[model samples]
Target: MKKTAKSLLALLALMLFSLSVSASAFAFNDIQKDPGKSYIEQLQKKGLVRGDGSGMFKPKSAITAQSAVTLIVNGFGLNIDNIRFIKEPKASDYFTKVKDNAPYAKAFIIAQLNGLDIPRDIDPNGKVTREQYAHWVYQAISKKGEYAWIEMYMTFKDEDKVTKGYMDSVQKLLIGKIASLDEKNRFRPKDAITRSEAAVILAKGITFVKNTKPVPQPEQPASPLTNVRMSSEAYGTEALKVTISAEAPHAGYGIEIANVAYKDKQAIITYRVVKPDPDRMYPQVITTVAAAVYISTAYTPVLGGEVQP
Candidate 1:
């Protein structure tokens, strides 16, 4: 009986150890099984996340500052090389110790430039709080909105109170209709947001921008000389000659001619005539034309020798 009890105790101890290991393991599906699974799946499809090697998303794990930077960088396809790091990010600024050549340093810098809520006392090693995660996500999506909404909503009086403004913004991003209100019809702003929740909000914001119609630029007037009229050659089989003339009161004007089919209205044809400075006495002879067929030509005038035309 003594031997049996000892064996039982040993088995119990082994089970406890196994449980502890499992808890520490970064299982990907932990987030996958969330009620907001569909939204999470959308984010995964967009290459925003990859579950653990075991095909599980560790949803509840506290995301680190580095991890958050990686996600925001990858999600928005930001350019890291051009990023300017804070003039002096002190050693204590990061929760995890930031090495000089850390791969995500540029990403972190970019996040800060774009107004991400990077903790001033950056605990590089510390877990990212749910509040911080939500704030960052809001900033990322709110960039397009010019941050007007984020600034207003972030000024809430209480972190836990689901203000009407907060609910409105959350509803703005339906996330496959998974973002429902609590009993008070308020979104718990201070609550730690799960990975699944983050994914849904991102997807909704992306969809909103995609669906919006882009503002159309006003069309400019077409050039006056749609077609050029050339007098027949004054001599034998010598090609027909044409001269274009223009004058700028203060400076010289550049004249260009091209075939009518040219896509860029302002693109000048090198083969066509180019007059640098036209004397007021003599009109600028843009080009001497020689073609078998009388094709229509387009002319453009650029002022002050600027390349903008």
Candidate 2:
């Protein structure tokens, strides 16, 4: 009897373990099989969605208005903190109903500005439908120049038959690369867009836009004045030393170089503004180099330089 009881207890433990394993497997599959997996994964990899405590993403679940705002913000690279909220919706305002303190307000504003915001009412507690998702995805693709004029007209108008005028416009814009007609040369516009279809369209749209964009030329090297260091040489003459520095790519940079003399100081030096380079590439090494020089100048002093209180 003792051995049998011990065996039963072991069997129960094994069953519990098996159940736990099965639950984990389900959770993992849930993320992979979600309809929004592509966007969710993209957002997750970009550090956007750190999913709630639940292991599952709950993809079929309704997205809150606030959550939608956050997704739009992170997905499209909008400034969330600095966006101003006005009581009335103006041409300049992004959202008509969103309050100043609303979460994801910046993203909502950007979406509105870019014409990507859905025309539907803002229902904070409502569930997003598959059709709505398609519309939003279509908006995103259109922003990237994926859909030709004809395709856009068809998609936006939800027409059963595309007119010749629309087709001609599409042909002009897309140059025959887009706007496919059926065997009867009829453009089917009323078809319901599927999730997989949307994914394929987005993939193609991003690729096409990127390939068609002009490649920017590398910027010219900075001159010797890129980095300037000043030191006190004498009571009347201050030596300004300059160094040229190159920076790596994708670095945040701001430059400010000024020479300020104290009110009672003997130095007559004044801050001279240098012409900013016209072809400055943002987030580049040159920007950092310029910023470093500016910072050094602010703290360094000439022989007669007076310290500010």
Candidate 3:
């Protein structure tokens, strides 16, 4: 009886470990040695992308506009807060075949708010193209009014073959250095955005958004430099604060400290782009505004007395 009980306990532990592995990393038979394996796995871990009920992640199959938009919306963390609608919100009302409770309904609403333009007549189930996806992403970021586009001015040989209406947006993608060209310097704007390609682009967009700096401000000095706190914001406005942890109040140490941080930031941006991927055609352009984090230092008096009416 004792031996049997021990055997049962060991089997239970093995079963639990097996379940854990499946929950975290489903063994998709199709994506065993695919190039986009890492991207898909990364998204899966983030809960932004999932498999189709079964334990398969059909990596090569074409994903529809609705599904693609849903991935993009979730992957980029788009949300609605104070939106107003004249009628009851329904996907079918705005789109031709989309239903109210459909999987893509919420995504359609959120994506539209961020400048994704899927026509009412178009089928949401239709496969999304590379140019169309790039255009929508460009439109999403264009609303921010930051990040001056440094256009390469180098035209693609197959530029004319790209679909109409998406030419300008696609150009912005190249100018902003988000999408890369092939060895022949072709953007392949007319091709369908494959699952692997979509995963890579969407993942990179998350990085760009994460790299955005907040307008930083320093906490009010506690007892005049006894305690000072600062934050490095990732998104929104950019800000910086300089301080000197001097042993005595008469020290001129703040200026020396500020110069080092400023120089470090510049060196990071310059040397960071040195890694050359022959496959990547675009320059490494993070979606962020320039002229952020200007070094400024000042002394404010610490008032000990209570406020007077």
Specify the highest-TM-score model's number.
3
RMSD of 1: 18.4
Instruction: List ranges where model 1 is wrong by over 4 Å.
Output: 1-32, 80-97, 145-180, 183-186, 213-309
Q: Can you tell me which runs of candidate 3 are displaced by over 4 Å?
A: 1-12, 19-25, 143-145, 175-177, 214-309
- Candidate number that wins on TM-score, 2 or 3: 3
Q: Report, for every candidate in turn, its global Cα lDDT versus the true structure.
A: 0.49, 0.42, 0.59
| TM-scores, each model vs. reference | 0.45, 0.37, 0.60
Where is the poorest 10-residue window by lDDT in model 1? 299-308
TM-score of 1: 0.45
The runs of at least 3 residues in candidate 2 whose Cα sits more than 4 Å from the true structure, single-residue gaps closed, are 1-29, 32-39, 78-97, 144-309
Q: List the residue pairs that clash in candidate 2.
A: 247-285, 248-285
State how far residue 247 of model 2 sits from its true place (Å). Answer: 31
